[model samples]
Target chain A: MSDIVTAAMLVIGDEILSGRTKDRNIGHLAEMMTAIGIDLKEVRIVADDEDAIVEALNAIRARYTYVFTTGGIGPTHDDITADAVAKAFGLPCEHDERAYAMLAENYAERGMDFTEARKRMARMPRGAVHIDNPVSIAPGFRIENVHVMAGVPSIFQAMLDNVVPGLKTGTRLISVSIHCPAGEGTIGGPLGEIQKQHPDTIIGSYPKYLDGKFWTELVVRARTPEALAPAEEAVRQMVARLTDSAAAI
Target chain B: MSDIVTAAMLVIGDEILSGRTKDRNIGHLAEMMTAIGIDLKEVRIVADDEDAIVEALNAIRARYTYVFTTGGIGPTHDDITADAVAKAFGLPCEHDERAYAMLAENYAERGMDFTEARKRMARMPRGAVHIDNPVSIAPGFRIENVHVMAGVPSIFQAMLDNVVPGLKTGTRLISVSIHCPAGEGTIGGPLGEIQKQHPDTIIGSYPKYLDGKFWTELVVRARTPEALAPAEEAVRQMVARLTDSAAAI
Candidate 1:
């Protein structure tokens, strides 16, 4: 028996859509999820509107094992992710004492007022568990399987550390790369057959055009490294044959 | 009357989800769409699976005026975007004579065979119009409101240039920015009220933490510069009042 855990990231922000901010959270989450053996199946970026965020959260969280959302958790009118997450689950949001205490202490230490806007950071959906934030005192939270994290890279990454250890691991994928100088047209037919045979595995062909010449990087992936040997051999042999035929012609 | 046009982008690739390749297409599309007055509303990254592509295409194309897809139109077994597009629209795909001629001649000039894999690039959904590719002979195609382009950055950018000119123009938004070294908690309440007053305009507050200090940049956006005078004055006055009160306290 095997377990495969899948995840999806919902990036909530108007800045990202407007081209004002380049997203670092999705790529970072992609790399981190892959490293931890969780398959990141999909990523959707929506504007910082409440209904949009709520709709996206409901759709993606239902499809994947875990859902992580970045952005719109800060202390501003634009930061509406928390409210959206609450509305998505039909849960009432209230001031969380632990989060309030943490933020109040941080604000006191900095000799700043714990203003009403700052208080917004302390609100959490009912029955949700709080996530730790090492960067700032304001914390993210977890409701069901969905984890809400800060949009800022430093805080989001810090909060992710808290969420990762609790997730179940799956079979780590093994990758085999073959750099073929042959264009995709020369290899596409045989490659399709290989993919059909290894239906359980993932075969991806990335075409590259550099140095005024075209080439392809063939990537074969599966759960087990030991099982990839034969498939890898098939790909290598196929590429070799294709390259030779092109030369002869 | 404000001609408001909205668009969405579908990034088709397994590489992006696997973190093997960071997406450049989304950011580039975001920048271009924003500059040309088309509001880039939603962006989704999906794997190269046909069902996933079709689902994403149908969902997004129905919501926005235009939908632009990048990747999966290449000379490889994994390149199935054309087939997916055809399935989504219930149209037959065929080898476009114009696309075939362009690719065949390009390959002939390079002394390469017009292999079946290369021929795959010429296939388009029925009734689709071709978009030119200045870098390579493989052309992108437009069917209904959806435009499908190559995943490679250079080629994707080239195809985008051709598709963008044909899109409907909207009332270009005018933006006004004011940087205040006040925490969002100190200004979010007032800003929300300001936003309520100018319901026609879009107000975004971006918070920043620099040099051990808190600051925020308030951005006001509206279609007409003349109409923005009152809303902008109110925002400037609010920020000034908030700044003054904090200083007095």
Candidate 2:
């Protein structure tokens, strides 16, 4: 088995906190991280305050293998992610010539003058590498372990596509989900015993209320299929026994 | 102006971090808090691990006036939130008689046995106040400043509705939104100046990409209409001027 690569996400925007805008980036990033064999351990959403951004960034960056941030990178006064990231690393935030040229040329090609606000998108922490944004011309940047992307869902996704190929990923976690037509209360005790028997697997019981009845979806995940199979079988047996007992009643 | 009441949310569940379940609670809580005159400052989504939950709960609970948590209160081994919250407060977790009676009667009404797993739902920290769960009979609990609720959206909302009437809230913040047909680059500079002039108000510029063109929505928020009006007007004027110039060109 490969070593685990853990990550954390920092979503920076006041619009999200105010509920004016619903966040699409967190789920997308979480799905992408899971698909790419990285464990997304934690996620944080904070307003676009520099102090808040710097504090969250510093706290998570030191703990995780990679840190992904979305939002606060636009051409506005509230867009202070670049400066906050710089402060987190105690490095200088300066305009990157490559990023500036990319935006400058794109705007010029569209017969629009690149204003100073537009130029703000080019700033990055020192020793950063630009992550290309295909949806928009502005580039995201990777400084050390932190990758800062745009808040726009399309742009954030596009930038992540560019960054993924370069990352060192772990082995994909294998998962098997079983639908148990019983509530958590009915299945919890035996499920706990199943979990103990398969110590290498992670078993989670998600309860759902549907059509005036409660049910659960049991998911068994492990670093390898070898570790996952026995757990999956045990869960299925437990579900079958529970359902049989209910049917008898 | 009334004193600000701040809050942070701690979302606990492995399903959320695994991307198997998309969170609806964060946005709902944010909007509700905004409407009820509470400042929702920060949000953290963590897995169902006990140490992770305790660490995050301890960190945010100390900083905010109130901390609201969702998930991991179910009747399963993975449902470790009550234990973690108890540990965070350095209090012993024990079974509460009131909660036990509620669930025992709920199951009895349905002609079902109150199994051991079902009884697990009655556990709570010492000195915790029960938060009524109208949807499901199992009760959520509040210990000091932390309000713990179920992860299900419907149940979480119901539990919060019960808790809100008793909370000390701040003065409601008024918001004015203006849609700008121009991109952030066109309105950012002037918007910054408007924000500086109206230091008492908060101006947020949200960029949206639609129909292959970029536009912006500017929201100005303040504790009163008196502080919100001038900033809102300034943003409107900036958008109007920017659009006129683009049209002329």
Candidate 3:
């Protein structure tokens, strides 16, 4: 397996930016990427404008191993993700026959006419492969490294379930958390030194305020359990020593 | 008032990227920005790495009217946002006397030692103005167009309340929402025409799946009520016409 497989998420929507909608997709994708050993390196949320979508899509897709985008895929004027992605890749976007057939059949089965607007869902960048959406028949597409999906959380998740199995994964990261009764103020100095000593591990100190008192949680992550254990132990010892000294004082 | 005021949010943290923390600040800030007539144009969530922070901060602050960053202001080795913002502005990052006085007094009042680690919370870019935090004594700072705030949701909100008064606002946006019993596929064609007819207003169609049926909510927004009213009425008439025709068939 690769040592690190990285991904970035692009949320394309006006509702989210306008505060009319709260995004549930970013957290879902972030957690999904983490569990599958892909580091979600960055996330960019842009509006539904084609120019903004093309610009952001081009920027992040060039840097990350994979880019997942949500929103702007429905059959509406604002649903311009397909065209924007095609522009980003410099490919001609047209109605894919397979996608057309799928959506056509779905609407037909429901005794509905697959209008020109419904057929718009079938459009994709040339040479793109359809990502199956069991929730709704309108398929998302994969053009190069970018996986474009719907913005709705349920459909996005359903599409992701179909996409995850095919991705190149990295070595699973091992994480250990140590709770500190003391605040980062009391332990941050020594914790920095421990981080320096354990160069292979990532040590993160998160502060939490509860019941009018502040405390810190230290999480150490490494590629292997062997690499994680020592850093975890060092953090535990540092918290114990500092909290003990603070209590004594 | 300005016709448009745009802002971007940069979230600095590994915890958010790693899926250990779900971001509440983005939604909170987005809603707040919209309410205050500022367009939240884009949002970028980056890691705690200084280079990443500096790059993203520079990219966004140069484009938007203002840039707000959340996270990495705490007293820890991983808290690198202040230094990163300073680097982006090519300024010296050192202990701000006012922030130092505020945090030191808070620690003293709480019967805690203001250690070197605690003092680290007082650091800010040179010539930055401190944004007051009522939830915590450690202040967030604003240098140039960038406002660096805390990761904790409560502290971030409190600091935002203090920062908003100083910002330049635009004309307040007027929004009208109309629900459609039909899906976007059924109403999308005429809706697109309505959007083209009202170029001054932004028409957004949001699809929702409830009770095994897909419906849409159309929201029209414009800077003035006059611009918004006509677009909203057009959308309402379009949805009514489409759903009625669909029902007749």
Candidate 4:
């Protein structure tokens, strides 16, 4: 409900920790959250161990406005995130009647047996609301501040889209970028001054050595578009002044 | 110097924290370390701030056997990883004569000016060794256990390939996957029993709901090829037994 919404991402699975899978979720979520004006504060990757999941869930959920977790919601023995979430929140995890019914209906339509293993998909923690998975009927759940979704990029992305509109958004985040061929030290001092002048705006510099010259890309971000304009102006002025100084030297 | 080789990754930039870039480096490093048996225990991502970089460097370098950092090593104003690494070790970060010589030669060969901004690429933390960047001349650094590499995938992958073989390796990690059309709970008991039998092996289950049927993918990992074979066999047997139970029910 605050003006600034802060969130943390918990990437679950040994694939991520073991490096077998290069996670595309973190970047996708970060970009989406920023566009919606929610600040992503931290990201932690943990193995699919229940204790680790529970511990991380408790810590992150308590610290941030919202916690988004991906992976381990599957019908496999290693899928323990749902149980962990229930344990972390001290809630009951049982097969939801509605979820089971939906699963049964979905499987029946495909002429598949609603086996016990499939029933695991119907389990939900008490007081949790399901997030529709259009790609797959095994719905993701939202318990308190924690939103548990699938690990697959396509499914995870689909689940996130469904969850975002329901979230309480803060001020819209806006940013501007400028590319300059200059070293950080040459612009570090003046950039600091610009930041001090525009305390509300956050300025970032990314330096790249391309084509044998150092080019620094400066990015300015703010909650309001108005706040971004002055910050951009100050950056331009400082970069020009730094370029001139280097020329004189 | 320790028998147990360890590694950590330092990610620099505010973009990662602000959720603009979902970091791909951590997963890549984790997988690579596992393959070589380096034992990646921890990872940290910090902002482009010098103090934050210094703090992370000191902490990780002291604890881990090897430290690998990606991002913020570029030639831009915000790219401060190089300076911060030098400061953390209490070393002078100055333009290395050899590095400058290399840069000048490389640039001249490419018909580009060795401008003052480009000179930033030559700065190295005192006593640091260079990690070759086949993609560009802005070499990454290696000091003690720390191996700095570029953030770009193509370049980072190349640098890693160059650096990995040099480090002392443990047993290689191998994995096997088996799919079962059953829920995790049906196999959880047997899965736990198998894990207990093979303490050295890590068994994981990932559940998927596709076409309205629950199917779980179980993966078993071990340090040695021989160990992986037995562990994977045990998982396959357990899954088969669970499948039988589901079919009967």
Candidate 5:
């Protein structure tokens, strides 16, 4: 396994494209991946089209260590993600006997009829391992490096919580942040020098305007607390330098 | 003048890719475009890499009616959206005289020194027009169909509010939603029939698991309120039929 694990998120839904629903999965996944030391490299939102999903899955899965997809795994006409994933991997998709049994039991527990539409949830790509859905009995699945998940924030989150613990992890992430009312260019050179000095730390600067004055919030993250302290100190010194430079100008 | 007014979003930042930031701009732009009758066909989140931004800009600008980009318009070293935009359009990027004047006045009002880094905020691609920034003096710009705005939610939102009023709107969006405790497959056929019957309305189904039970929320959207009613009724009838069928099962 590579020292640095990377992942990409694919959000599939026409509802998202039409703006009928706001997507909450990206934020949830980003935070989760960060906690587990997996670097999330890119995110793409596409319609519920099979061609789009297949294209995105093929592109991202080949590039990243893991590819997580959300939405379009439901018992609906538009729920084509399973088919797309199967097509992407060139795998066979059929109703898994195990998944169907679990769905039947779940439906019986709720005193609901397991209609043919509901049965659609049991269809899984051949050779895929089922992901436990604690909130809903309809299991998500993992085939090759791709993890298929539901789009609902709460359920998706729960499913991710279940799935992440099983994956290999690197060092835990640690971070520190500082704020200054100076533009980035004022600190750019110094910041670049500090980054050069601390190659292990990731330094990010976000600029914002508060009370009609420009300000920036700088954050430094590292794999260890030891590596983070020097980065934080370097950032603090750079911010101070920038502040002084601003005052002098 | 095109019958189909299309738009694409350019999200610029490494923070988003690094999992340091979860973007909310795409959903915001998607909703805004739908409401104003502009079709938001594609969205791409590129890192703050100049070459990548230029490549994405060249690809999307030629295909869409409008391109709105969010992020990287900050006063940071990595915030190179303006430079990349200028490069993409093959135009010289220089400090806009009007924007520089406005920013100078803004800094003077707060008794702050307008450093050279702060002057970077005034830079725009040649022949670009400034979009008013009610929140800050870092004005966004519109060069042809491409509108570049800030990435921060509050600032992006304010910039959009100001920019939207000046654009031409073709239709007002109206929507109707109904919740049914039935799976989508049960309703998929009926939903398809309804869509066939009313070709004007867009009917979508979102399946969710709430309180440990499966349910689908069906929505109908159209240009007119009257069209919404018929679509809504059709969905209702479809749901009723599905429920009846499930009961028989």
Candidate 6:
């Protein structure tokens, strides 16, 4: 936990809050962050209002090593993310000329009119770095440690792929999951004891009620394989004991 | 906005943050809250750590009219929501006889022993109101305005159904979506002007790239039909103009 590189996400969209659109970025980001060394500590989903965006940005940016915000960076009236980011950082927002050219070229190639609303996508806070948009020409921006991204899942994933490989992350946490046919109540005490014994490993118990049978899973996570091995063995042995007794019953 | 009943959600689970499980509660709760006239303003997903849970609870409870927390209330080691809620409220967490009796009866009917881990589900904050769980025997609790429910989708939905009908709510916000075959850039300017004109209605522009074609949607929302009707008409006219222009091209 001491050396774990922590990150947080801010998901901004009215559609998500209204249940009109289910979020896809959170799950994809979580999986990718876990595969790398970053510990995704928290996620906050807020509406498109500027105050809500600023408050969430300030809170998440201050707490974690990195903050990735998705949504409201589009060519529309409600796309207030860039303006909110500028307000949060006390900086002026302006159109980045380079991003403008890139977007203009993209539109030209597609035989579409590059209107003023499309130009709005180029705006970002002062001292911001452009994050590439592989799927679209409208680039996401990075101010300090906060990475702004598109709300659309494909564009968000592309921006994340462009950003994550370059970040400073810690040791990738190794995870091992044990699928146990035993119930949580039958195995909870021993699992807790095992978790306490291995303080470095994070042990989680997940219960599933499937086919009218209650089964539980024990997952162990550690910074290194060496740390994960012992805790995993403990869980396997405990599950074996419980499974044998339950079979006898 | 004056009478809007605002709500926030805290999803407490390591499994969601770790990407082992994709959260299904937020969308379900959001849709249900919208149906009953509550604006789900903010959502926070935190790990099973007590400090994180307590911090999210304190912040959201002070700001929102209601807080609904899902997960971390099971019969497992990581099921620490009850204790965390108790710590946040400065209350004693004790076994409720009513909950214990209900769970005991349910387990007896299934011919299973009510073990210690099972009993942990009965522990709730002092002076908490028990929210019935139709799927499982363990009851969720409501302390003040923060409703603590199970992470499982079915149980969470059942608890929400039992709890939401009793709460005082405002006028349900009505929404209308206009699917425009045109792009966001074509409609952004006029939409912003219309939004400025009709300050009561919230218009959101969502762009989509579907089936290799570019399309956008304008969603209009207002608390009353009287407020929404004119704004919806304006969007329809705007989209009609955009479609004509694109056709001419």
Clashing residue pairs in candidate 5, if any?
none
Q: How many backbone overlaps does candidate 3 show?
A: 0
lDDT of 6 by residue, A88-143 (tens): 99999999989989989988887877888889998999789999987777899999
Native-interface RMSD of candidate 2: 1.5
Best by TM-score: 2
- Tens digits of per-residue lDDT for model 3 on A158-244? 999999999998887779888888878888788899999999999999999887778888899999888898888888877777767
- For each candidate, report its DockQ versus the true two-chain complex: 0.64, 0.74, 0.74, 0.31, 0.45, 0.67
lDDT of 3 at A54: 91
lDDT string for model 5 (A122-184, tens) is: 898999999988877789999988999999888798899889988877666688879866756
Error of 4 at B116 (Å): 6.7
Clashing residue pairs for model 4: A19-B31, A27-B22, A75-B207, A117-B183, A184-B77, A207-B75, A207-B76
Off by over 4 Å in 6: A247-249, B247-249
The CAPRI-style docking tier of model 2 reads medium
Model 3 TM-score, all chains together:
0.97
lDDT string, candidate 4, B86-131, tens digits: 9998999999888889889986886656766567778889899988
**True-vs-predicted CA distance for residue A235, candidate 2, Å:** 0.7
Model 4 regions more than 4 Å off: A86-116, A122-127, A178-200, A205-218, A233-249, B1-6, B17-24, B41-44, B50-64, B83-135, B178-199, B206-218, B234-249
Q: Which candidate number has the best lDDT?
A: 2
For B1-249, candidate 6 gives per-residue lDDT tens digits of: 577799999999988988889999999999988888899999999999999999999999999999999999988888999999999999999998999899899878877778888899999999999999977778999999999999988889999999988888978989999998887777777889999999999999888877656688789999889999999999999888877785412
Poorest lDDT segment (10 consecutive residues) of candidate 6 chain B: B240-249
Residue A200, model 3: Cα distance from true site in angstroms = 0.7
Q: Candidate 3's residue-wise lDDT over B106-221, tens digit each?
A: 88887888988889999999999989988878999899889999999989999999999999999878898898888889888888999899999899999998767899988899
Model 3: which residue pairs collide?
A: none
In terms of lDDT, which candidate is stronger, 1 or 2? 2
Query: After superposition, which runs of candidate 5 have C-alpha atoms over 4 Å from their true positions?
Result: A170-173, A181-200, A209-214, A223-227, A240-249, B17-22, B90-92, B168-173, B181-189, B196-200, B223-229, B240-249
Clashes of 2: 0
Q: Given the true complex, what DockQ would model 5 score?
A: 0.45
Considering just the first chain, candidate 6 attains a TM-score of: 0.96
